[model samples]
Target: MAGGMFIFSAVDTQAKFLTDTLHPFQIVWFRQLGLVLGLVFMLSYHGASILRTAAPGLQVLRGAVAAGSATLFIFAVSYVPLADAVAVTFVAPFMVTLMGALILREPVGMRRWTAVIIGFLATLIIIRPGTGAIHPAAFLVILAAALFAVRQIVSRALAGSDNTMTTVAYTALVSVALLSVPLPFVWQWPTEGWQIALLISMALMAALAETLVIKALELAQAVVVAPLHYTILIWSTFYGWLIFGDLPDLWTWVGAAIITATGIYTLNRERLAARKPPQT
Candidate 1:
């Protein structure tokens, strides 16, 4: 998960850099192209069977949600600071917990519920609606986070029916296809060699990050690895400072700390619940 987060941060860094010259939609489409190419290479040995899934509808839905999430996030990052954008997206875990309770009918204790509330409040601290600290674009990150939570929910539903590679492949294919629909209107081909290289790197990093995440989840318990996602804030802050000369303010860090702590707590609670034996 840590490796995956770092790679994703790199992808975000590239996307932010490309935003200077390309539209978010174009950047997103290019990122998906890398994912598709990477998946093709990674699964080449497995042959076409690797793409087969019993839940094609659900897979397509998940891919569409992922496309929406990616587009919104890229758009948000184009305007918002990387650290701020990342911090706000951390709210997805809390949203996932809520959705699990309401949609999955999973048991969520009061303690976890408290953590959820605290997590959201922490997000507000970062956004601070009435204050000037918040960017109007930050809300796009929040919306993206919500869609990401939906993706997680759908993923949980698909877990029993499909392998990891199948999920990843379908997502790449679907997202690329969906995002391509707007290419004619917003597409801008790179004029410089460095721009082309950056776009390719962005795609490769995005694909690599997704694969690493899938492997991490396969190797470790979700609760154990999920907390590592907070590491993205550190990487994002570093990249933002080093590459863009943007540092998150004191309040951003404070809110991010609160959100991270509560998110970890929430995941820990869920892990503990899973360990408990079923009630009669």
Candidate 2:
């Protein structure tokens, strides 16, 4: 998961760079291109049966949410500092925790709820709403985070009924299809060789990161894997400085620290709960 997060940071950095020349819609389409190719490979290997799903509606919904989330995120990063954009998105796990308890009937105790509340406060600190420290585009990241949480919830629901490949294939197909609608209007052919390279590299990295994250989730509990996302902040900060010569100010760091602390605390609570024997 940590490795995947690192690659994800790289992918975001590359997407931000490409945004200077290409539309977010076009960049995301190319980003999804790698996954579409992987989907083709999966289909060939597993044959048409791989696409079969008991929850077609959920699959389609997840795909649509996935498309929206990816586009929103790419669009957000194009405008805001990458670390700030990513920091705001840290709200996603809190959303997932809340949704899991409320919608999926998963048990969430008071301690986790407290952590979730604190996490929101941390987000407020980063965004500094009335002060307008961050761009309006930051709100788009929040919307993206919400959609991402929905995707995860839908994934959890489908876990029992659908194969992982099926879920991934649907996301790739739906995102590519959705983004294709604007391609003709927004598309700009890469004039330089480096632009072409970055586009392909972004796609390959996205596909690889997707695979690693899926494998990590399969091996560990979501709570255990959740905290690893904070590592992206580290990579984002590094890449933001090294590549873009951008850095989050002191308040952003402070808020990110608080969010990380609360997230780790919440994860610890989950781990303890998982270890406890079932009650009579």
Candidate 3:
């Protein structure tokens, strides 16, 4: 997860820089293109059976949601500082916890509920809507985080029906297809050689990061490694400072700390809950 987060941060940094020249939609489409093509090659060489999924409709829906979440975050980062955008996105885990209670009918204790509320309030501290401290586009990060939560919910639902690779492959293919619809309209092919190189580099790095993260989850309990998700904030801050000369203000740091604390507490609670013996 650590390696994945660092690479993912680099991918996002590249995407944000590309947004200066390319539309977010186009940037994301290109990012997914490499994965899609690789998946297609594997399918062709192996067999069509490799693409089989028990829940095709859900897979497609997940892909669409994933595409929207990625695009919105990339778009938001174009206006919101990288660290601010990443800090706001930490709300996704809390949203997932809230959605698990509401949508999955999972029981959420009062303490976890309070933590969720505080997590969102901490988000407001980062964005500070009324104060105009951050761009309105920051709200898009919240919307993106909500969509990300939805993706997690769908993944949980599909866990029994599909393996991780099937879901990932479908997401890549579907995202490429969906984004292609708007590609022609917003598309501006990279004008310089470096821009083209960054596009390919971003796509490869994203695929690598996704693989590392999945592998990490496979080897470690989610609760044990979940805290590593916050490490992206560190990388994002470094990249933001080194590349854009931007840093999160005092309030952003404070908000991030509260959110991280609440998230870690919630995860620790979950770990404890899982350890409890089954009721008679």
Candidate 4:
């Protein structure tokens, strides 16, 4: 979980820096490029065959969903407060609870169900429907989470069919290919040494963050890792404060706390379930 946040934080910092000029789609293209490079390097080191699976459609869907989520997240960051954006993305985990039950046929008890409800509520608090006009960017994030949740669910289903490396490789390849269409309109020369450096760094960090996140998932239960989604906001708050002198309003933190608490409780319950003795 900590590693996942670490990866996402690096990616967020990179995205925040580019939000001023680079269209989110272009930045995501760079990220996809970097991920492809990283995937190539990692596979070379691991000596894994790239096309180890046949789920091309599923792989492409995962990439499209992830790319779209990232584009929306960058949009949200540009308009909404950082913590609020982070809090909104936390909805992915809670949304997953529903997906797991419905699509994967996983059992979710009342306690877990209630936690999912609270997690969804945290998002409502952040958006606060009809409480003055809400930021349109928030809805982008909601859509992102919904798509991302589906992607994660797809990953869960694909796990039995493919190795993680193939999954990452194919997703990056598909995303980079898909994003290639919009490169011409928003393309701008990187005019400064620091700007070039920053883009490169962001790409690297984005890859690092994802690798770490995947590692976190391997080592920890998704339920436990789910709550750690809020920590990205903590990091975002700090980054926004340092970079833009921006502080999240009270409602952001309040909502984030509720989301985090519920996420942790759901994971803890899952952890306990995993610990129980097998039936005779």
Choose the strongest candidate by lDDT: 1
For model 3, how does the per-residue alpha-carbon lDDT over 1-280 read when each residue is reduced to its tens digit? 8998999999999999999888999989888877776677767876676579999999999889989999999999999999999999999889888887888787789999899999999999999988999999999999999998787667666767776677778888888899999888997867899999999999988877765765666566666777899999999999999999999999999999999999999888878877889999
Highest TM-score against the true fold, candidate: 1
**Estimated TM-score for each candidate:** 0.96, 0.94, 0.94, 0.88
- Across residues 170-240, which tens digit of lDDT does each residue of candidate 1 receive? 99999999999998999887999989999989998888888788767666666778889889999999999
Root-mean-square deviation per candidate: 1.3, 1.7, 1.6, 2.5
- Distance from true position, residue 208, model 1, in Å? 0.8
Task: Report the C-alpha displacement of residue 124, candidate 3, in angstroms.
Answer: 0.8
In model 4, state the lDDT of residue 49. 69
Task: Return model 3's CA RMSD, one decimal.
Answer: 1.6
Q: What digit string (tens of lDDT, one per residue) describes model 4 on residues 74-133? A: 877778766667778877877787887897787789999999988888878878877853
The TM-score of predicted model 3 comes to 0.94
Q: How many residue pairs in model 3 have overlapping backbones? A: 0
lDDT of residue 51 for candidate 1: 85
Taken over the whole model, the C-alpha lDDT of each candidate is 0.90, 0.89, 0.87, 0.77
Better of 1 and 2 by lDDT: 1
Better of 2 and 3 by lDDT: 2
Give me the displacement of residue 126 in model 2, in angstroms.
0.7
Judging by lDDT, tell me the better candidate of 2 and 4: 2
